[model samples]
Target: MGSMSPIRGCRRTIMMSSVLLFFVGGMSATDGAPPTWTFVTGGRIVGSPVVTETGRVYAVAEDRYLYAVEHGVARWRYDLRVRPIGPIRVSPDGTVVVRTRADSLVAVNPGGGTVWAYRHRTEIASFEHGGDGHVLIGDSAGVITALSATGRVVFRVAVGDSPVTTILRGSGYNLFAATRDGRLAAITDGGARVFRRLFEARIEAMASTADRVIIALSDGRLIAVDTFGREVWTIGVPEAARRLGVAGAHIALISDNAVWFFDNSGITVGDDRFDGLGDTVIAGDGVFVAAGNAVYSVRASQPRAPVARFSSGVGAIGAGGGRVAIGTDDWVLSSFGNAHATSRPGIGARVPYWRTSYDYLFLKDQISAGTDQAVRATREMISRVDRADLAGSYHTIRELLIEVATPRTPRTGRVIPPDVRSAAVRALGRLGDAVVRDFLARAVAAETDPLVMVAIFDAFTDTGIVSPEPILEIAARYLSRARGAELSGEIARAGVDLVIAAHRYAGYVPDVGVELLRRAMEAPFPREIREYALTAARQIDGR
Candidate 1:
């Protein structure tokens, strides 16, 4: 093993042990062989590579080119003229199918010729290949369309309002479609709706076993339903599952911190923890996990270990044709045989877990104290805390801030000191999470202190909220209240801040906050408020 060069901005690295050569549960240590073949792509790979049964690999890159490689050599390249979306797939007839950013699906023949192309009127959300050589596509309009191998529409059905995120083919001509809003619909092959089930959270990923369809929710719940759409079982984890893969009767749920395996009845089989996050695919009897810069092949009976490591971060991974294909962030694609291989010994990295720091407890205590100096110190500490630690501390900090900012004696008209409240609001704003947007909106509506109002408006802006309709509507109502009345100095200052915050969404949602900005421009408000409002409105109008 060679000494590793220092990785820029990396805090820690794990050194592989030399004496570790034991085989566990029929899985042996890698023989440390090099990759069978390596190919460099024109750009970073967008999704996982697809390997056909004939050892041909298909990969798409950001450069808008679909590459074909066999045995480490470039076979042919086709220009799609637009970046492809999602992973490239092959139909039963050996035609390559790829969806593009232009809302079209292009199928290429074995000789790299365009066989046919199908364009959708709406954005293609998800797609899957059916058993009868048909392409099942789900669009943003909640319509599922099945196209024959010749690019003809076989049938179309409207599932629901939310965009479909996944499509799976079940047993005996049964099909399943899951939407973004947590609605799973089971449809027959002839477009007849069988049943539909709705969950409480967003559907993140889905996979199917022999007799059950596994659904993963954004709230960290896994559900299994039978062919008749009846709930079979459910389980919970700490983090949401990003991807799901099925190997025989075992299901693998890949989350940020770990890979959990469950049996046919939702019983825990085995699990492995690793740092960083990546994609996974189940091939043969093993689950290939791409994490950080390495791809680890984990058998159901063995602990996780890296089979291949790369110099750069892995972008995507795929397994087929008795080999594993990996795409790296450095614009390279490589293939290796099923046997365990390693580029070199004693080379691995793990991100340090910083959640164990004691500073979070100290900051929480100081913020809860609610003194002016304590709040100030807490604010400084919040800014210094790493963003990774925010997940662990966000709820604690938010609750403390809400408690300190709320008035304890509303009946007597006595409130928490405005300065302390304002500081806490500013700290909440610095959290940069939109989950607190509703709380900030409610505080702005109920608070009477103008200084705190200004802080709340600024915090709302700092949340980086993509959906600003609710807050914008509130601003319009507030502006309407001050239309003909004399605006106090502090009130005018807060109004100006609100206008400035509303300006950030000018072109993205031109119509959302236009009424609020117009109201700001017409009020008995100060000249600064009117100027900001006028500028914002013009930007929205593209003047």
Candidate 2:
């Protein structure tokens, strides 16, 4: 789930009931509908489109032109005079850049004037924009070059024999690059090598933050490595990732037709798919996925049927400055939402927003269906409702959640599946209120499954329900299983992590974590649990 940025205002923000669209003469909106507009261009768009704060759209078309569009009109156009070699890049200073097939990098200002141009000997394969007027360009010959804002060659690094396929800019002056021959290299702002790692399979996609770099291999395996190039964890994805992007707290893997989301720990949180060759880009609080003739908007915090879909072949997606824009194959550039009200599609009429709940409890479907598509939708809904305090439908949704979570005994020959019950227990906590607290208190008291007990305890922290009574009750039950199932150690550790997280959420000082850790250490817990407790204590003490 996407972490909520500090509560921005007193007004409660609501997630869309479903994708937003106006019912036209006879058309009804589906779960993936949203209001949109499109501007047909002169040629096919090959690179990604960028939306600036002012709602101006920038995109490159095969017609050898770079366009700046606003309110459905071309504000300015910079003639590249040659087809772009790779993705279009925009710098922090609002300079648009594209490496042309003519072996030159051209930076154009918003006014359609060329700021500067740099010539290179080899074909540029990929490039990344590092702030402070720095641009990192990599070529087919495995060479990486750092260019100053004024088009000066700052530094260059060469790797193996294959082409450089991905370049990711990191915090400060550091940047990372990957080659087709399975080499990952990091470079400092001064163009010095930080570290490099080689893999067996070629890299298909890459994304990074200040602390970690995530790479997707050709074999559908995703790996996360720290700045030092040490493997943190690896996950086998169902499909090879065609593009990787970071939206808020989730890592997005855009596959052939689906978008998979992973949390910081490399666990699959949720995913959604569409028909067509899809690509994803982060825009505001949503993930705008472009596939075929439509662009779907998936909220970063929760997946509720796509909140919106626009009719356009979105080749590239970009969001910034409170607006979103997409470029299509038919030479159309479009912007969506209130920022471009004058260009709103669908009869160009205002539509009032309506709030509603899902027809069925998705939490149940996720646990019972066992299908990839069903699980994805269910997880998305759970993640969204867990964080979205939707007050309007709270009573109705709460009643339904309670009904689903009611524990019951089965016939003699069958028993309630642990997975199914666990999902119920989790839904109770996500509801996160007095009624939920009452339900959880009774359920945990009789819960025998260690896994369900652990999930319940974790949800307390997840929902910010910090009652000490339930915390103590579940903690004791968790510690009782210290030497049980093989996963007992893992569950115990998770409990400790949650306790610390809860303390942080409640605005307690680090000493509170220190105190909790000390208590766990002094208890007669298993050796592994005690060791883990001691480590957590020391880490907190250092703070």
Candidate 3:
């Protein structure tokens, strides 16, 4: 059986912060349950939730919806016909552009109503808006699609070996796509003939300032490239990591557990002794990082502080205009106290969560008896949230539990906060149900904190020769959006280690464990974690 739970955001391309605050008396990291989570809500969470000017946050989620939430209440919701897994493109005209999971490119009015929707041949993995309302997008099969303002498809060309991330830039309309196989593809207005492959490993993430293109390689190198695709400077870290995003000249990237920063020159210059982001000292640092339990502010020369501390680690950080938004395990979008957050009227008494939240249970109910039990537990837990003597932001989540969860699961007992789902995931490893498998995948996709992913490592086993490929694959994609030092390194190692660790479950796998041994030799983990990984590797190799 598999263990359930994991959740994983965004901001300035995101570096640049002039805000700071001191945090005291943190909330329950765990609700004292055998394994618990403390999910946080109160922000704008669009699919690509980013902090905006004046402190408003925006984000979109799998709910097939886009949200503008400030404080604990939603500002508006624009429903889509399908899921939205792509980043949002805010046009200069104040138009909100979104790419749906069904491969539709749609434009929305600021009022949360649809203005246009364009469908394509394949599911759209992502999208971006450029000048004259031209939207650039890439599909699951490595094809790029360009659409005009009126939802008409203009260009659809195949690009990259495995295009995972992309950006549209330059007044001349140059498109950049970072691929899984260590390549960057550039598409011009005429077509996407420009291409360049770099590094021996995967390109986990990509970022660009006005003049520089930054690539976060799967092998742990932060390689800077010019517009001509020429390597500028390559900064390598102790462990293979990913670059989350860059704001102005400030860059935020992550390895496993900790988040860190660099400058336009590619030097590690942010606070390393503390949280590393959102600090008074790094007031002008332009870098923002969301780590376990906190969203950080960092500058090149100073230490950092917390912007709004939550019990759970942030799944993502998004910034726009003057505000910031965050996503948590509970799948809720939250923002800090900004004018929009404060002045924004109640979501006009709209209900929290979508009607489809509980529908997942019906979809999987016939799968097994275990599925039924799990669903019932979740729903039960949600009910307690309504009557339990809970205080704080959790009060706002009661409605979500009822709406998002199926009555069959009711989620049992006290509210499980996002911070502690890791323990629950670890404990549920013995159950091999498919429900567990799917939930685990979801947890990983939205997980912003590595501790939670670490917990998941114990739950699901690939059941093969203990190949680290799957885990590495997940880590590579995760590092693509992950920011900061502490987090980048830990997650990269864990993802790889999980691959080696899975061998323990096979009992009769192969002895050709080159990746495992290599990881044992070169992985940048604490002695204890390294030794554990080595033992798991040895089990597969019989060494």
Candidate 4:
């Protein structure tokens, strides 16, 4: 069975800073729980929750209703009459539109009154709003249509020979679409074609900024194209991208089990693995991912670690204007810390969590469970750490050290011991603070096993520890002994690790590694150590 204990931002500049502080400081201060306000709905939410500028929340449910929620109470609800065919969208001018499986587009006013309806001949496969109060629709019959603000048909034309799978609004009144047969087409608002391009692989996902449109293919290729359909740059990923989205210059691509972030120049900025990721959004300086029953927020400017997490059966998420909101399979709509219209003054009663916190449970299991127990946990906790919440953070760090720094597995009968040590060190680095750094440095000194020492050095590098004088002193002693007679390859390997760590942590090799590497290359040190040191020196020098 899938692990039952499952797992799983916005703002302008000031909004971004507030969000960072909320998660960075709020988690440990509030007993490791981030504050959340949830509004219960009548049925399962089928679409993403939309939060307006004034903090009103709108969401669609499988029960054929669209709800307008103000604070924790329903302001009004309109019967959608049929299941929503697409996500409920609020236009720039505050017109709410939802497409039904009946192949009709329904527009509603902000006060829950019906505005207009446009009926289509075939089932609508995709739809998007043209920013200037125009609706773009694509149907399974290979037709593309544009409707004005009043539901008047602006243009209707056949674009391809297969179903239109994607539709998006570009600069001004231009519309872009992709077909099932690997065709991409762009047209102006007046029905004039700009360009069309065909590819060998089917387009799996498409996202655009103001100037470029990015498409991810089934063959694990991502291509950025201009408005004229000219290729700008392409990147070959390890796996086919299942979903794609753009947040500023950062492009987020979700493959089978990992999330990859790339800049417009095609250089990778962030990459990490998370299981069961369902949706992703980039707002402010962070990337928000929805997985299982949780929404995880990872900062883009800093380390690729989850800084904040909100627990719910998150089906879809949306964030903008300094507010973050989510819709869940449990029919609950939630918002985190924003002022808005509310019938009540304070928040509702806290919703008790089945598992208090995933990270907390993982740490507890690591410390309390026997090595033989098949305990499940999450590798979360990637954010800035400080002294304000040092108690819990240090306690968890100690548990990690017990699990990882131990000489052997707790159980002798174990056949394949868990590799929790490396994970533990990585967690320590993700924690990223003076306490963590000091603990790791002490662990490196006390550790006798060569293999564990290697892991400790790697962790030190990840935690931004450069110019480690004490570790270097120990490494020089071991290197000298290996040169004498013992020939300890592991010790030499640790020296090489420190060399690389210096380069990565502080952007340059320290004097210790450089001097030792040069000496090893000249004389009777073992051939393996000489070769490794030479390679490390070259890498450091190149950087």
Candidate 5:
């Protein structure tokens, strides 16, 4: 669930979501259906896609380019030097505003012509266009910029090093900028700091809901204040989510991938089932999931119903009048309540779970591999994983992520992909069902992959299937008969220190493991393996 950022992996400002052509198409009203997939290449589409009243979908990709799409076809594109990291925002009337890490702000007309362009004093983060002819922007340098409708720089004020909180506007063109530096300031459209309040921590989000204000803070807490800036209610969200949506007397948010719908009264009324989403939005009546190569619309109800589903890598979604405008890494779709299923392999509702479930391990690997930008692209790739459908290569995919996570430190984070056997072992351990214990034990006995074997070892450990007796037996086999010292060394790779530490705690530091250590003390295995095993047995063997 960690976002793809350099310092912290959860920030949205620099993220990008881009994946190449994949063919997974099949989606029906029922549980089992084909998912359709298409390849649309422009660049990483990390920023959420936006749709105006006319139904044109606006999206940006990592190629540092912004594009407009309609009805699944490409339109005009605006290429930029610095990638647009946040979603394109549209004013209620139809003006489009885009922000880039370069602090470059640009506005365009509906025809994709540049209406105004102004490079900020520093890189601007997420921004919004106010109906009052002002564009509000927040940047990583803790500065907020307000520009006139004509792109004239109005005023700039420093906030802190963190990205600006959501630019919030209220009645009479009053503007508020939330800062992570623990201050909420009332500013005019010109970016003049009118008033300020000291809060508990940095505020991450600020929004207006008809009558009250919603300010979500860095501490994973939400503070509702009145128009006068007095605190009314404070709600705490222990697990942070990516985006916050508040409008029409309702609050839509997520924690741990579960969408929580709260009314203006702040009462929890509805929630969509938990599913991992690279990005999400709250608009109209449905909760949309921009999961790994596709987008899905799940209604907010007693049992959420599926309204429409499209390819993963979808970075943005806008809902209205039975239509949901979706933007993916490469393509865009304006689904007008289409519930039709596909024939090609396409991700269904289970994507968010499977991708997030198995991808956590891979996500860690990718993070350990590379730069924040490489990781930004990698995160979007993992977000769209569905191995059963050959549309996505799980192994090649993992390799790509490993390259991105620790690109320079390639020696590690390249662990072999867990096959069904390893996955079965983990499953048995988790299920606690005794029936599969022997099967998992046998599979472990015959396993060849060192990484998979250790994972098997953990599964058996988790299931209490491996005791000192079996450990000793396996150690004896590996010691003399099992002719694979290299593999033994591989098992010894994750650090025999932790293994010995666990043995010291569990009283299972096997005598045979010790004998193997003693016999192969000079073998190909690293000195650390022998040292730890010998040290552990001597320390705890009751000899």
Candidate 6:
């Protein structure tokens, strides 16, 4: 742990005074006003901007700086020295709290001074602040540690066997912890375990009201549990819920393409469908949604015109103190007050396709040129072939990528770079052609580079081939080789990725793949390998 110090500096801050004109989408407001003030950061914003009740804004960017902005100007920015994880929270005492990639929780005061920093032993999975100025941090080891405002530990308790995914403060000092394996526990203020309930599916998101806790499961079920861990209601949605927001008796559920609004009784009131919505926050009588390149306010499942739109895609949105803050993908932060803004469309461009055989001939010539520029051209070809609608040249492009990715003896003193090979392998995986699965498996067998091996496993998983024979053979070979020897971290991680890839085809070869993974569980590999093997084996055995 290092000393608490504020990194004093400001990135170029742009303050907009008037609205800029741009093309408006259908049903968009042409007379929309611009944001009251806008701020730019050095990097893309990580999570949603946090706006306090006093109109102070706090945002964390990929540049590892937590910025405090007031009236369109940066008040101060504190350097976390590493990327911030999860959300930036404002505690009850007005102290800004943020978790860093260094596994530490840093507290910054209103004056941009460091108050305290508490380092955790394991990777933090869930973090929350209570009303009484206490911070509850959950780690991957399933332990919950509570710290007071002064950053002293109050209690540490193990809640489950898997990683804790969420932690929420319930009525009074009672705390609720949800694990990755779907177990929810209620702990007392003094860290006494009261009860635990296990669900059939993983919990994805959780929100709390005054009287009950709302949870969204990976199986598309929204469940409400009381303070005593009793279920109140459970309703299934068409798709898995991504985020949840609770406001009074209204509940907002955001999925991949739609937003569903429900009453307290789990009855669907209204729903709206959008293409690229990411997050939602409930304020007053409406829920503000981050969709595409704009933030929209929806009431009764209908978008009440456009609220604010930006040049780039909006990553997150927040509202407080009669103001709204939006962070865009291009590292722009804008604050609005009663302004209806619209952005220019065309964020997504059409994928270029091969129109004729000459296109394939040109690419083949570039790949066969055997130079550094050729390697760059090959990389560009990989990107172009990924997810594009290939016109009759799919096999040609796939075979070209396979040739570049396959480990072979160098010819004419020409060798493919490891990263280029990995990218080519991943692009083949994204192509999802079943014809390439066998090639990828064989590559995995001959591949010695750990990164390329990981890419091969990822490709196998991405192909959705459903044949478990290749993965099982490769996993068995690795496990047998690692029985008496310690594996490096990269090798161990590749082994875990192989197990996970095999898990995808568990239903196809239950007996062999499950047995191989079970043997891997008992093998003398790293803890991560063993854990992943156990998890895959259990899923295959339907335990």
User: Which one wins on lDDT?
Assistant: 6
Query: Which of candidates 4 and 5 is the stronger one according to lDDT?
Result: 4
lDDT per residue for candidate 3 within 1-543, as digits (tens), equals: 001111222221221210111112321122211211122322223344655453434566554556554443345656665665566777766667766645566687666666777766555666676445777766665666666777765544455546446554631234577656666765445342333455687877776666657788877788887654667999886655544565434666655545567787888766353333221111122445665666655445555545555655466656554344555444544443321122211111122443344444442342234544544544444343323222122213322332222122355443334333444454333222234445566666665556666556545542111234554456545544443446555554555555554443222323333444444344354566566666666665678
lDDT score for residue 489 of model 2? 62
TM-score of 6: 0.57
Query: Higher lDDT: candidate 1 or 6?
Result: 6
lDDT of 5 at 74: 52
Ranking by TM-score: 6, 1, 4, 2, 5, 3
Q: Where in model 3 is the C-alpha error above 4 Å? A: 1-48, 54-65, 69-76, 81-83, 168-173, 190-192, 271-284, 329-334, 337-543
Please provide, for model 5 over 66-172, each residue's C-alpha lDDT reduced to its tens digit, 9 standing for 90 to 100.
76655444556665557566656777656677766465767777666677877665556558775357777777666665567788654445544566756776533
User: For model 1, what is the C-alpha lDDT against the true structure?
Assistant: 0.65
TM-scores vs. true structure, each candidate: 0.57, 0.53, 0.48, 0.55, 0.51, 0.57
Which one is best on TM-score? Answer: 6
lDDT of each: 0.65, 0.60, 0.49, 0.61, 0.52, 0.68
Displacement of residue 331 (Cα, Å) in model 2 is 2.8
- Indicate whether candidate 5 or candidate 6 has the larger lDDT: 6
Backbone clash tally (model 4)? 0
Kindly indicate the candidate among 2 and 6 with the higher lDDT.
6
lDDT per residue for candidate 2 within 1-543, as digits (tens), equals: 011122123112232111111211211224333334334444567666676767676776665667676664556666677776646777777887877764678888767777788777577787788545788877887777677888876645564467888888753334678999999976555554545678999999887754678899998789998755678999999988888877666777888877788887898888876665665666433466765666566644555333234454445666676555555544444455432112111111111222233434444444344445434543444454554433233444445445444554553222345565566557655545445656667766777777777777765554443335446545655565554555566566656765554443332424434444555565454688878877766654564
**Candidate number with the higher TM-score (5 or 6):** 6
lDDT by residue (66-117, candidate 6, tens digit) is 8777776677778788888848889867898888764788998888778888
State the local distance difference test value for candidate 6.
0.68
Clash tally for model 2: 8
